[model samples]
Target: MRQYLPVKKFEWPWSRRDNGQNEFSPLIPKSGAAKVEDEELGHVDNEYQTGTPSNQDHNSPTRIQPHYSYSLMDYFLKYFLFLCNLVFTVLGLVVLGLGIWGLSSKESFAQEKIGTIGTDPMLILLTLGFLLTLLCLTGCVGALRENCCLLKMFSVIVLVLITIQVLFAIVAYTVQDQIEGYLRSGMLAAMVGYQDDLDLRFITDEIQLGLQCCGADTYRDWEVNLYYNCSAPGVLACGVPATCCVDPLENGTVWNSQCGVGAQLMDEFTAQSVIFLGGCLGGISRWIKQHEGLIGTVGVVVVGVQILAVFITTRLLENIHRHKAHA
Candidate 1:
């Protein structure tokens, strides 16, 4: 039979009076036969005095505790989160891969090479895509882990990156011509235009002399004949040399024979193509948005719809099965 010293007040780190030993012990209630009897007999008195808590009263602690259950709504939300994350991750990887590949290889060289799909532009696009993908992947992991903080962070980052990319793309598409010209100039700055191939009139003595001196070169000779005529008083005739010109010649001889400048319209077409592609990318973004849940609420709606559809289909199938069984 263990004996308990009468407790005054149950203070933490309780003090004990000792006979020479000075040893201290916790004031635990004794659990002997006599103590049990006392506990049973004194139960009402204890209740009146200290108010012994009932099962329900003690249950308040558990009731106040947060729920850790996984509901249907939770499952639906997770599924939607997983779906959106997966789509973004895959699409982002595709964009990053193509952007990096195009930037480094001439094999996929784009016409507006500086930044329109193939050059430095591809690298920028790739970086943005990579970041967006990473954010989505992070969001997916957070969802899997049920980490609200991580999900919020990732969502904000993705939203910001998307906005920035859209704004810049729009601006770039708007100034497509100027941008292309800038890119082209940077690419071909090392060489000069072939000056002697330009047409030059030699309708005066000084011009004729200059032509005679310079025309030894094929480019200069071509230029001289391009604008030469027999009608001028002080200039040489184009075909017969300096002495042959006496009087009038056809007006055609006054102008260069080359009818038109052979300017290529391919550059213009390429700029147009770049603008078109920008529009397409925007469309793709819209398509992706359609699949995403609102504040991640998309999952609930989808699951509900799917569940309804499944229930209907299942009933129809069951009816057919019953009909066949009867038949």
Candidate 2:
């Protein structure tokens, strides 16, 4: 959309070379200035269009556009786009492989489970990885091959993803008040399955250790687990998880697995000395509040990169069209 400064026309190698004057000379203003190839290229700053007037049909050629040549910056941007997508393609493949591994290890695709694999949690990762790989691979091949179709597909998909992310972000921000309640419910559900689900157990332990917090809302919240309930007839009854302990290691080395025993039976004052009394919800909230700036910066950077890729692809497609039109 940028208008280039009008300058004296420069002739191509096969141009008439008739002192920059030809059949179209009357149509062009007599800007009797000497040709400056470098300045003309610099001013265009993108596709360099050159008149391709044929010796047979001068009047007819005047209605057509000139042949287009790409500038150095255009080539650089195209290659840069290729490299960026190449990197993401590799990452996408890795993620896809990991998702496949996760699903295989869990036998989610077994004969009996195959019917339900679509609803399996691991399928989420597999879908994400597949889409990422397809999108980035399209960009990579399109850039390298100068294929307008593939590039346009990549641009459309990227724009859709960006729009979805922005809309999701807006909705999340609008419903911020309900998010904490959802987190608490999910945390509680995870706790109830702590002993049965390895993934949930690992996540719960990580949250406890990382934040030095105990349950969803408090240490007593562990009672939601059947084995940890006060009325349960087991050693773990009325006990919190070892991860809730203030110091779960004995002699600063061995893990004191029973450090949180009977923690739920103790008074707040007593439990404070043994295990974490606060809950992960508070810790998670504080963590987010503290690092919101970094999170926002990351979000902005991601959206900006998508925008830049779309812009680069648009320019490449434009130049390709121009070249094809005048060929």
Candidate 3:
């Protein structure tokens, strides 16, 4: 009867056994292997939640979130580039407009003259203006949006343009004799078309008046023109343009268009009194030499600006890369 009475088992909250003595037995203690296994399971759970290996947790700290650091220089450069490009964009449009106006004013787009448009000076302005507008627009948008592709394109174009300018400078300095010859030929051609082409005539007149020189080499060079040749039937034959005259105004009141009439037939000494005897080539050379310092300064500034832009673009690209890597 005494052996038949049942004893209630003491159960531990974590124990699942119907006979609960296995959880905290006085006679048979819990195995050290079981305690170690339980601790390992808890560590694996923590690692899963944190997305890290348990062993590496001690070796490395948790990753910190990434943040963009916008420096003062970054802000300055961003807006500075945008503003510079905006101004140049406007300037390019103005140049394009002026080129179109010049071409239209001279009727250079007429069907008969269309074939010659490629060689027109206005075409050069138009092409240059279009390129400048496109290039500056890229830079402006790229800076604002922080677009890598656009910035890269802008940088590459700028680099190419800078290289071209440098090469042009080098060629101009190295081929002085050839360049002078080319210039002489170009001036003569312009003079030949002076009466027929208003653009050429205006350019010729302005050069003559501004440089205080006549033709390309001398006042006699006007004979190259059909209308100004001595054998021509026109009244302008053997005469130079009024721009060649030292004082084109009569009595400092009215413009004297006939001041240079028959001046090409005059002797050098006599012509010197009526019109300039010196060539525009010498005048141009003198002007360049006189302004060489200013010219060099401007060239350096332009090159420096391009170089700075390259540097800024590189910095922005690196910053973008860093951000992406962290992300």
Best by lDDT: 2
| Order by lDDT, highest first | 2, 3, 1
Residue-by-residue lDDT tens digits, candidate 2, 1-327: 235766777868886556664634645543334235544655565334444323435354346566678889889999999999999999989889988997898787789878967655567778888989999999999999999999999999999999999999999899988998999998998899888656578889999999999999899999999999999999999999899999999999999989988999999999999999999999999999999999999999999999999999999999889878878
Looking at candidate 3, the ten consecutive residues that score lowest on lDDT are: 17-26
Worst 10 residues of 2 by lDDT: 46-55
Structure candidate 1, residue pairs in collision: 115-121
* Error in Å for residue 104 of model 2: 2.4
Candidate 3: lDDT of 48?
90
Candidate 1 ranges with C-alpha deviation above 4 Å: 1-68, 107-119, 159-327
**Candidate 1 at 122: error in angstroms?**
2.5
Would you give me the overall lDDT of model 2? Answer: 0.88
Off by over 4 Å in 3: 1-61
Please, what is the whole-model Cα lDDT of each candidate in the order they appear? 0.45, 0.88, 0.87
